[model samples]
Target: MQIYTVGGAVRDRLLGLSVKDRDHVVVGSTPEAMVALGYRPVGKDFPVFLHPESHEEYALARTERKTAKGYKGFVIHADPEVTLEQDLARRDLTINAIAEAENGQLIDPYHGLADIEARVFRHVSPAFSEDPVRILRVARFAARFTDFTLADETLTLMRQMVEEGEVDALVPERVWQELARGLMEAKPSRMFEVLRACGALQRILPELDQLFGVPQTAKYHPEVDTGLHIMLVIDYAAAQGFSLPIRFAALTHDLGKGTTPKDVLPRHIGHEERSVKLLQQVVKRMRVPNDCKDLGLVVARFHGKVHQVCEMRAATVLTFLQETDALRQPQRFKDFLSACEADARGRTGFEQQELPYFQLLLDILKLVQSVDAGAIAQAQTDPSRIKDAVFAARVHTMEQHYQFPLSQSVTGGSG
Candidate 1:
């Protein structure tokens, strides 16, 4: 049997990046031979084994053909004669099709090393159209590799695939896996642009695509359109190296604007609430972790709250915090501030006079940091006094800084 390192391990090693996991493909090896050699059979649908000593996965050389629809519709043929080149031809991207022999020789029939040096991403073969998931992978690669551009032929192939209704073959889980990886990249905004250009975003997230060219009242938004604003926010968020959930929060923070009335001055009076609902639906569909979904919802809901708290009383602020769980953890509050700041900074057209209001909100959130619900809940002091003091301080700070009419800001009569 001839064993060779394949896929990401070989690609990453060539890129001078540290390889985390290594996958081996065994050519001319039968399942029975593997079993006899003490390898443990672990794969269900295909002939794969775990190395007895290293515990790494080793799959027998196999060829596949599309037998039905979607990624799982492939019919795999595992035999002892499948050549290494034959196996490489079925990979999604050229860069991932290269292989490293046991003696450290690189095999690149697709000229993957040339593409890598030129910062280009190309499909391994026309067969890339078979599995629609490859489109998402291409977008993810674009997001991760800042300098890479898709070749014209590859772009044409992707467009043709989209036109042929291949996107419908994708499952939500696979879509989210690629999307999550893109969001976690160093420059996630690139992912959106690539997806948009490739027609993937329109199929998977039409709501997001609707943001393109939508006018925001120039007085508040100097940026050209909502889509550009969203991209800027995502870029800024990624530059800060925020967590995946927070980055998602920044990416989707303004999603509600697409559904709001275009004629209105702000055109987004209750968009935060709408965005929360939209995020819930999306997160549920994508099967995201519950904690991440909750975090995303909270960030989207309160993204605009800071700007409206000018005249709020301490009691009102405390009550709001209690209800929203914003102060449930230090990290959550920090994420809230980051989301708000990214939203504020992403817009280009607001009058310079409005900067103070944004600064005021930031200052107030920072000033009340020690007395937030999380702290109050952990403190051993008297509950009633602690709540009363925090509430009063919040109100007094708002009045001193913003001159906001407390009576109008708070729901109940201000004490």
Candidate 2:
């Protein structure tokens, strides 16, 4: 059987990027022949095998046909007769449909190398419209290769897919899967931008989509569009190399701004709490993981207070940490702070502003958490009073370090 490296391995190699995993397409092999040759069969729908030595994935040349609705409705055809060119034609992007022979010869059946050199994200064939997931895939690839521009034809097909309601048939898990991957990319805003351009964002993430036209206080947010601010925050999280939870928190932190009443104009008085409520709706609908959901919830509800904490009394600072369960989950508390910092730096002309609140808040939290709450809990004679005693200790400890005037402390609180 003749085998050739295909898909991402070839695409990334051509792009001069580090290829993490290699997938091979065996043009002349069957499930039984592959197994007999020492490869292990793992395919459920089509012939896929694990290499006996490297353990990398190797799939027989295959083609898929649309059967019904959504991504799951597909018929796969894989056999020894299928050509590598035919298999490559079925790929989503032109940049990914290229293949490489074992002799290091590049195969450009669909001009993937040319598109890669041109930094264009183009579909391999007209059949790109057959799969709705390709829209999300293209958006994610945009985020991955931040310098690449999407082909106009590809975008037109995506918009048509959305118009045909093909995007609506996507299941929540697959949507979340793509979204989470996109959020962690080097530049996440492009993912949202592409989705919005295709009209999929309005259907998939309306909470964020509504923020595009929403105005914000120009004095505070020079990038006065609430949607743009959120995108910037998410990009900042990515730039900081923060984890998925932190990035997720940044994305959903300002959902309330989208829902603010028109009469309120640019000022979002209770947007923090409003953001938390909207975030809940998104997490539930998207079935986001609990770790991400929990932090997003905390950041949504308390980000404003956290931003302004340096101005508030130490007692209130202690109460804020207690309310967020920061004392119990220090790591998550740290993530919450990181998300807030991303927000603070995401605005226009504010990225390099020497904001002292971040450092001050960290120092305050350290001092408050240093109090021997365990010892204080042990000293309490009444079991029910243990929580009260620990709370009192943290508040008392915070009072020692944060004795500044509330008005002075509130400086640089707006994010």
Candidate 3:
């Protein structure tokens, strides 16, 4: 049997990127023969084996035939007769269809290297439309390779797939998995752009889709379009090396603006609460993680105050931290601040400045958290009064230590 390194390892190496993992395809090998040679069979639908020493995967040369609908509706045929060309031809993108021989010789029957050089994301064959997951995969590739452009024909095929209801058949888990991965990529906005261009985003994430034509107050958001502002926010978060939860918060922080009343054009009075409500629906529908869902909801609810934190009184600041559960989740609280900074800088001319109040707000959270709440609790006679005493004490400490902007003030220390 001849083993050849294939897929991402080959593609990444060709792009001069550090290869993360190596996948191999074993040609002219049977499952029984592989088992006899110390390779353990592990594949569920096709013949895939693990190396005896390295434990790396070595899938046999296989061909897939579309049997039904969705990503899993595939019939796999693996045998000694299957050629490497056949296996490579079934892949989605041209750059991912290249393989490398054991002797370091390249086996490129699909001109993947040329496509890589051209920074083009071209499909290997029409089979790409057979798997609905390819739509997500292409979007993910657009996010990862920020410089690459999708081939017009490939985009046309994707649009046709969406029109044919292929994207609708994608399972929720797979959709979320791909979307989350895309969000963490270098330029995540490209993923949404590709999805929107293909008409799949409106089908899958209608809340986010509705943001495109929505307007925002130009004085606050020079970008003017709420959707464009959020995309800029996501890119800024990515540029800042923020975590996935932070990026997700940037993406969903303004969902309510999409539903603003026509009479309130360019003004979103209670969009914060509306954003939180929409965030809850998305969290349930996407099966988002508790941490991501919780953070997105909090950021959506309080991002306006977070942007204008300099105007908040000590009690309002304390309430903001408390509502976000910052005392218990200090790290996520930091992430929340980072995402808010992304929002502040996402505007057209504001990109040059460090977010207006990062260090200032950070000092407040740190100081309030440093307060001895247990002592305040012990000083209280009534148990129910303890919580209120501690909060008052924290607020008092903030009031004494920091100076807040008086241009505007938020009343009621509850969000």
Scored by TM-score, the top model is 2
lDDT of 3 by residue, 1-415 (tens): 8999999999998889998889999999899999999999899889888999999999999999999989999999998999999999999998999999988999999999999999999999999999999999999999999999999999999999999999889988899999999989999999999999999999989999999989888777777888898899999999998888899999999999899998988888899899999999999988999888888988898887775566767788788788888889888888888888788777788787555366766777899988999888888889999888898889888878877653334322111
lDDT of 1 by residue, 1-415 (tens): 9999999999888888899999999999899999999999999889989999999999999989998778888999999999999999999989999999999999999999999898899999988989988988888888888889999999899888888888878899898889989988878888888889888798988778888887776655767588988887777778878787777778777777778786773456788787878877788777887656777788788766665564665556655665566554656766766766667666653212233444444455666554455565456377668766656656665556544433333121100
TM-score of each: 0.84, 0.96, 0.95
Once fitted onto the true fold, the runs of candidate 2 whose alpha carbons sit more than 4 angstroms away are 377-387, 406-408
lDDT of each: 0.78, 0.88, 0.88
Supply the global lDDT for candidate 2: 0.88
* Tens digits of lDDT, candidate 2, 15-48: 8889999999999888888989999988898889
Candidate 3, superposed: residue stretches over 4 Å from native:
354-356, 404-415
Clashing pairs in 3: none
Error of 2 at 29 (Å): 1.5
For model 1, name the residue pairs that clash: 222-349, 314-391, 314-395, 315-391
